[model samples]
Target: MATFNVRPDIDAAAEKLGSTMGAKREIKRLPEVLWEGETVEMLATGSYGGGTGLVAMTSMRLVFLKHGVMSQTVEDFPYPKISSVQWQGGMLMGTLTVYTSGNRADIKNMPKDQGAALSDKLRALIAQGGQPAAAPAAAPAQDVGSRLATLDQLRATGAVSDAEYQERRARILDSL
Candidate 1:
């Protein structure tokens, strides 16, 4: 098992869901598939492609996990790769559809409220250019001369168009 940070609200929600035997089992298996710095934003249980699994929305991606007696399956959708999400609610449950470039996944039988909330959050994430709001780490400063030389080389090789070169050159100069 692995350990990663989870949002406070998601943790509380997970605890409530963990009271069920199946949910507890799935929750315990969550850490195994998570990335080192990934944070779980939301979680729900649903059926996809006829397999029942846990659907988790994390800081960087969406994941579906199913553990059988001797086998386990994991499917992940990175934020940038997702095109859109759709939610349809019924009396007691809802369906979530996630679309990517060449594929789509339908997760059904999710709790109505959870499905709706997840859809809204996913939409917000997509609207924000699929990036979570996190402070960027400070990058090591490079010498202005070397930066300009690199930019010039790129322009010479036609890697960057003239307009782009001009814009970048101006930006580099403005930093001085």
Candidate 2:
């Protein structure tokens, strides 16, 4: 087993994974391994969503080991090799080397810093566990509405050309 510091933003990765996967996977501190480990047990499984509306799902059974790495085994679903695991602070970061080339929703378009940031934020939130702060006053909901109001004020003072205002207004509304 190998150990590494949890990145500061690993909470985000965990949160994202939890949200997408429908549950928070637990982690346990291993006495013998001296490392972090997720608390989920498993048989072999893999899922992939399509670019269209369909999703692919598959599963298989495997010989179980009482003390094997779930994270490493999961990465082997579409392939047949154990992935590497690293521990950061209170979180575990692991590589899904076999699935890296595809657009899996859980891993797609993920910002590298996001996971560490998420982990740090989650730790803070857990430490300060309490009701959320009361809502601040809501800003206007529509982006165009706010931009148009600002544009109106600017236009009243001839701050923008008619053509410029029209172009900007069109762009903002189109974004909606």
Candidate 3:
């Protein structure tokens, strides 16, 4: 459960989220992504009125959850995965933008004091170094024939969309 510093204004919520967006959703169990020793630090709710959600942080990971009247979206990023965090606005309300190597999330409508505190925590953790991600295993180099066969199978099995299938097939042919 989160204790909000500012009482949220329901009528100010965005059309997509509805006026009652921030109403609590089930969070009785810890998310599976939490590591054994992780501890929750900051917990906040409501953003510059764009929607209602929770931004929870641990020593190693940042978790975001948007709860809507009918839908909920959740995202998690380890400190090592976050390339940067941006703070916008001041004291009363603002936004925090977090960037990863390949993705970005703009967490807005936060109070200035909380935002600054969260930013400091994020920076400190990042500076100290974060949990290292396991490197992906490299795929063995395959012959052109085998690569083409794999692409064909992917297309047939609907694992690859049509455009991707065509592009891959063309690339494989060009390689040969």
The list of candidate 2 runs beyond 4 A from truth reads 1-140
Candidate scoring better on TM-score of 1 and 3: 1
Predictions in order: lDDT: 0.73, 0.28, 0.56
For candidate 3, the 10 contiguous residues with the lowest summed lDDT are 7-16
Each prediction's total of clashing residue pairs, residues at least 3 apart in sequence or on different chains, is: 0, 16, 2
Name the best candidate (by TM-score).
1
TM-score of each: 0.68, 0.22, 0.53
Question: Which segments of model 1 are wrong by more than 4 Å?
Answer: 1-10, 16-21, 135-176
- If both were scored by TM-score, which would come out higher, candidate 1 or candidate 2? 1
| Model 2 lDDT tens row, 40-141 | 112111122211110111121111112222331122122122122121322333211122134222322222243344324323333443112232332444
Model 3 C-alpha lDDT per residue in residues 48-81, reported as the tens digit of each score? 2355576666656887766565655667788888
Please report how far candidate 2 places residue 63 from its true position, in Å: 57
lDDT of 3: 0.56
Q: How much is 67 displaced in model 3, in angstroms?
A: 3.1
lDDT of 2: 0.28
Clashing residue pairs in candidate 1, if any?
A: none
Please list the Cα RMSD from the true structure of every candidate, rounded to 1 decimal place. 14.9, 19.9, 14.3
On lDDT, the candidate that comes out on top is 1
